[model samples]
Target chain A: MTIVLEKPAPARSGPGAPPPHDDTPARGARALRALGRLSRLTLTRSVVVLALFALWELAPRWELADRTFLPPFTEVAAAWWELALDGRLWENTEASLVRSGLGFGLAVLCAVPLGLLIGWYRPLADLLNPLLELFRNTAALALLPVFILLLGIGETSKVAIVLFACTWPILLNTVSAVRTVDPTLIRLARSMDLSAPRLLQKVVLPAALPTVFTGIRLAGGTAILVLVAAEMVGAKAGLGFLINSSQYNFAIPQMYAGIITISALGLLLNQLLLWAERRLTSWRPQPRG
Target chain B: MTAKINLRAVSKAFPARGGRESVLALDGLELDIGAGEFTVVVGPSGCGKSTLLDLLGGLDRPTSGEILLDGAPVTGPGLDRGIVFQQYALLPWRTAAGNVEFGLEATGTPRRERAALAREHLELVGLGGFEDRHPHELSGGMRQRVAIARSLAYDPGVLLMDEPFAALDAQTRESLQDELLRIWERTGKTIVFITHGIDEAVYLGGRVAVLTSRPGRIKDVVPVELGEARAAHADLRSSPEFALHRRQVWQLLHEEVDRAQELEREAVAR
Candidate 1:
């Protein structure tokens, strides 16, 4: 007499886990009630966002600040629409995404494997860690001029700076992640006569994944932020370039549109990474509301 | 059965830490576990009971002397020995069956056979429908059952349990204890169950080994004589024979517990 749900059984451990102990349940009715409540919560939560939008629209229309500089929300949206329709925004966004993708991809390739090795062996970590600490403490943007001087102000410098900024969080976090795998699990694996390699592959990696993925998500955000700053300095086309050019050319609404697009891009990238994290680490009990 | 496991003058010492003197956990300890015997080792909090189990499991070497499994010396962890830790120590990310399959996979059993064996072991521990549940999804009792199933699935001859049910509630503990007895009867494992509970030792052990306080040595061994009732796994806790055995083991342990507490008190005061 067992009923298997499609979703992995969310046991009573998680926040939104089913209340199996409760007797009075028409499953369909309960789901509807939950959905209704969720919709209500969504509406209530949107009030703040809507209120902020209203403030932006009214403050500038009423001349709270100079309308020439701080145009209303609608004007910015309209300017964004024009740019999007003409594909100007698209062109710049593609350039920015390409730079970010290359830099971030390279960082992952270099950092994760390096982090694993440095974390596993004590002697290697001892040899490399002081050098890593020295570099990690030196912020990436502080080396912006140095990067431009070395790699030049082309796409290379922008991508290189983004890679530099993204590397530390990914690498350092991975090292700690491997280091902090519960010793109990290691003992259990050892008791099973697992070889050293098998122990790393099976026990250490899976245990360290949730933390390691956390590092990756942090780096994803870093990739965007650092790339934008680098682009502002010397890129021909990117969200940062668009924003800078619009401000200089006195196209205030276009600048606001570019700034808003950057925020949206950051939010979307975070969401995508979070989705991947959820897919891969589904074994972990997720915090639900 | 002859002594399947043997410890001859076994001792372990912890190196001095933070300018403190070295702590001797065990000294001149002698013990023997017969093949297919349910030998429960009971002691005070700091009597090196766990250290003894670690030595037998070959996770740690004895500081002096030696531990022997069969005729050979115990050198390191092997599939022949399985340990059930106090904390359940389950990989939280793995399902019950997946966890059971961990050892099977280590043994290089094919994927399909591993699943079948894992399911069989999970069923043996009365977790048939719980094969897919993660450790967090299960209750404390259920989690420990999965751990037991996992240790047993690898077909280890000697199972070293270090307070496996210590974290469980009283009712869960008793039920698990009964379940363990049934499993032992079925499997015929050479089990060395460690506990601080006198009643548990009396109930589970064919012979209970009472260990003395800090710098532990074998204080006494009480041969449980519950006979027919124990064999049936019946209502033996209330029986007069069970009472006598409980009292006997408690008496042997009471003095050592006090001595260990006094030493702990002095150390904490310092």
Candidate 2:
């Protein structure tokens, strides 16, 4: 169980340092070294992934499982290709994405300002705390029937369910973040005689942004989870609906394809949120492990 | 000249938990700081040194009596006073220059002028070429320097520094003290500094006010007779006058510290 780690090349040269030799042999040696490092970094993971795929492809053919219920990797790939060619995969993906985006956006739009207000004003927080706790504790999925009854079985109910599920994390995390801001910083701001609005703008908001982003990232994951569950209950054209329909019709290969598509979409959304978090909090010091 | 600050029978009390009797932090403290003077306050731990600075900075109010600035009563926090906190309370999200520009921005200074003034003050504090760096990127000493720059940039008449260099290394503390002396000389602003270190108080203050234990009040105000060229004299700390002043402050603080410890023990026993 030897672990090989990739280390970047040491940076020895600076502006005042002498230039390195530009001969072909030296350049060729440097290129070879970089190539070796790259392979050491990526080759092991690639081999493991390929081996897994090969095992999946071979298991069905070897009669390890019933082919109708557990089709080979190739069959799933072929079904996915067919769906893509007919535009069903793209349409379904777009539908799921739009629902999650709208629900998540609505949650952020409502929760953030409310959270800031609740966090900043103690009276408001005291008034809202018990009610918010009650609603948050009530499982979002259990409200599915109620939402459908009131909002109907169309996109509204599905999006509304997601909005309900996603709002808590963003709201609660923001409130805690604002409340826990360093008191010394607030005193410093006060010493400057900053007006109430200016204090919120210059100190409170920026101080709490990193924690607020954490809430948003959590909400993103919740939105996807709730969206998929809601779509399964009643929807025509999302990854969740695709999986449900395929399972009912005994199209195991299509069901696997739908599951993989949802996983891929979740991964992409998380990465995008992480990128935004990094850009916005560039001034924050990196935590030392 | 009229005093820059006049504290008349100032007292502060905090409500204790569980409906207990209030704890007195400061008690009928009367003092006056002349304009353009450097006044250092030294006291035992838990002597409400910070509470005193908070009142003077207008971050907190005295429960009784009045604190007058120039001829007017101190109300709330205002642009007239600038504070440098011990924790270097620079906003982590802002760059060095941005932190210095904070008070100016609050006072509604134009963006262009704020930048120019921030740059000037940062240079004054010897933080030139480090304007874009964030507080976390800089060392503790550098962060304090930036905080000083921030306080100065606001152009306040009085600078209230609450043990600004207490967290720095000994060498860093010495250099910063010298830097502060130079700045005070150049700016001629009234400075009220709080410190636990007697040496630091003696080195920096033209007048050192020694405070008593809990329910703090001024015990003695010792004048530092070290010459005007003390900042340039590297050996000032080792000079006889400096040591004498340090000992005087230590003697006053020693009794107060013992009293505070005894009070704590009795409280715990109870």
Q: Return the TM-score for each candidate structure.
A: 0.91, 0.93
Q: Write the per-residue lDDT of candidate 1 for residues A11-30, one digit (tens) a residue.
A: 47767876765533455456
Quick one: RMSD of model 2? 4.2
Docking class of 1: medium
CA lDDT, candidate 1, residue A189: 83
Q: On a 0 to 1 TM-score scale, where does candidate 2 land against the true structure? A: 0.93
True contacts kept of 2: 1.00
| Candidate 2 lDDT by residue in tens digits, A1-289 | 1234334444448978754554645665666777777677688758998897788888889998788887899999999999889999999999999999999999999998889889999999999999889988998999999999999999999889888888999999989999999999999988888877887878998999999999999999888888888889999989999999999998899999998888888888898998898889989876631
Docking class of 2: high
Each prediction's fraction of true contacts recovered: 0.81, 1.00
Give every collision pair in model 2. none
* Chain B TM, every candidate: 0.97, 0.97
Q: Each prediction's Cα lDDT score?
A: 0.90, 0.90
The superposed Cα distance between candidate 2 and the true structure at residue B192, in angstroms, equals 0.4
lDDT of 1 by residue, B6-43 (tens): 88899999986785778899998888889999999999
